[model samples]
Target: MDNTDTPSSARQSLLDATEALIYAGGINATGMDAIVKASGVARKTIYRHFATKDALVAQALRERDARWMRWFSEETCRAEPGPARLLASFDALSSWFATPGFRGCAFINAAGETGDPADPIRIVAREHKASLRAFLLQLAIEAYIADADALAGAWLILIDGAISVALVTGDLQAARRAQAMARCLLPTFFAPTTKELP
Candidate 1:
């Protein structure tokens, strides 16, 4: 048997193909036949791995969420620590926006595709957002921002708005604008003094 014929390989191929197609178009636009053709996996093999299309989509999204978070973290970590790192997130986003075939955020697209609140795709989308918020909250805490939770929430709004606006207007500068706003807002939360002055 060929190395690519393994169950794991087949599953991963399906997921990779599905993610690519979904990113290019949308969940509704991509069909099982397309996935089968793109992945080069037999229909029975696809069903063996995923009982349904929704199941396959959910798995693909989960994989995407993990991959995106890893990439974001790596990009953000490249900046100086503390507040600088927080602002660097925007720079990272700007780079992402500039990438070829940039088509808004995958999570946002998935959420908008499904109207059902309890849908698996919607659930994964929400989870992705929550994870991003948590990452921002961690950054806020590291920066010693007062009301870290609120700061994180504000950051989330700015990030989401910037992404949406960039997609609609094709303006990559949205990230820089959002970063400037974040910088202006950061002074409101100063790190607590740990040592008493003489």
Candidate 2:
């Protein structure tokens, strides 16, 4: 069923609009007026839900993280819990990074706009990263890694590091390297094969 007719749906539209703009541009660059205009929702409505621009930015990051996590769960489950799904996630990230006008990860990019470490936006950003690390650890375990936590941490560092490097260097070859490294490091956890007597 279409949800656009509901208040919750309208609120979601506002969140989606804000996220798209803020992610494509920067949180500092996207203002309340622009969000209201693009979302076709009244400024009063936005203010009604979110008291200030900072609140909106924080909510937008949370919503963005939720949506991303949902998509990641789906994509990472498309194949068996091993190299195939692992590589698929990298492919998805690469494609997302290559999307038109993709500035960077909104949470990561937005953290710079705030001075306070305890700012809601920065908290949301940190939570998003932590959630990703946890998810990767779970995935690594299912892939049968001997030390799933360490392996997942390494892989996540590689994945996020690649994104940062790609955004800075304007090169995506790092994604390929990360994928290769993951494949190389993963097979060590598989159970050893037993020989069949002739």
Candidate 3:
């Protein structure tokens, strides 16, 4: 297994290892030494790709977000845009939580570990949350909510709460229940229209 093939492959290998470790434990608990050992790559190789642990963590967060977004789009968009799509997002997240090496949201976990806003990991976590809020706001606008910003905020809180509760209790049912609530909340927030019925 000569991994010294190309820069691209090496970069991917590092990211894969980083994600594995982060998923297993968390960002703070996963150190460079663990990453090197888990990756089966030399320390130099890891350093070549990332200047520091912070850099590696930031890149890993971005990589995780990208993967999650792809999965979300595929799962949530399989059906029409309505309760189905909203439920699909939660369903997908629940499925992710049920995966073999199930762990809580990496961004949330990283933020907890960093504890300081100045940390690079914390910055990445903030960006992740901001992106989710923006996404929800866009969805609310599309749904024709009178106050898109407020509705998005409310839904975002519910979504976050569901995720947190599911992780804390190790119960997927919480998310499903939350999904159902979202179905009700959506229609109530928006003005009565044909699109709102679905």
RMSD of each: 3.3, 4.6, 2.3
Off by over 4 Å in 1: 1-3, 191-198
Among all candidates shown, the one with the greatest TM-score: 1
lDDT comparison, 1 vs 2, better candidate: 1
State residue 143's C-alpha deviation in candidate 1, in Å. Answer: 0.9
Residue lDDT tens for model 2, 21-106:
88877888887778877887788777777898889888989988998888877867776776577666677677767767756666
lDDT (C-alpha, whole model) for all candidates = 0.88, 0.76, 0.75
Could you give candidate 1's per-residue lDDT for residues 42-82 as a string of tens digits?
88888888999989998999999999999998999898777
Query: Model 3's lDDT to the true fold?
Result: 0.75
- What is candidate 3's lDDT per residue for 32-79, written digit by digit as tens? 888877777788877777899889878988888888766766876676
What TM-score goes with each of the models? 0.93, 0.83, 0.88
Model 1 TM-score is 0.93
Candidate 2, residue 20: CA error in Å? 1.4
How many pairs collide in each candidate, listed in order? 0, 0, 0
- Which whole-number lDDT from 0 to 100 does residue 136 have in model 2? 84
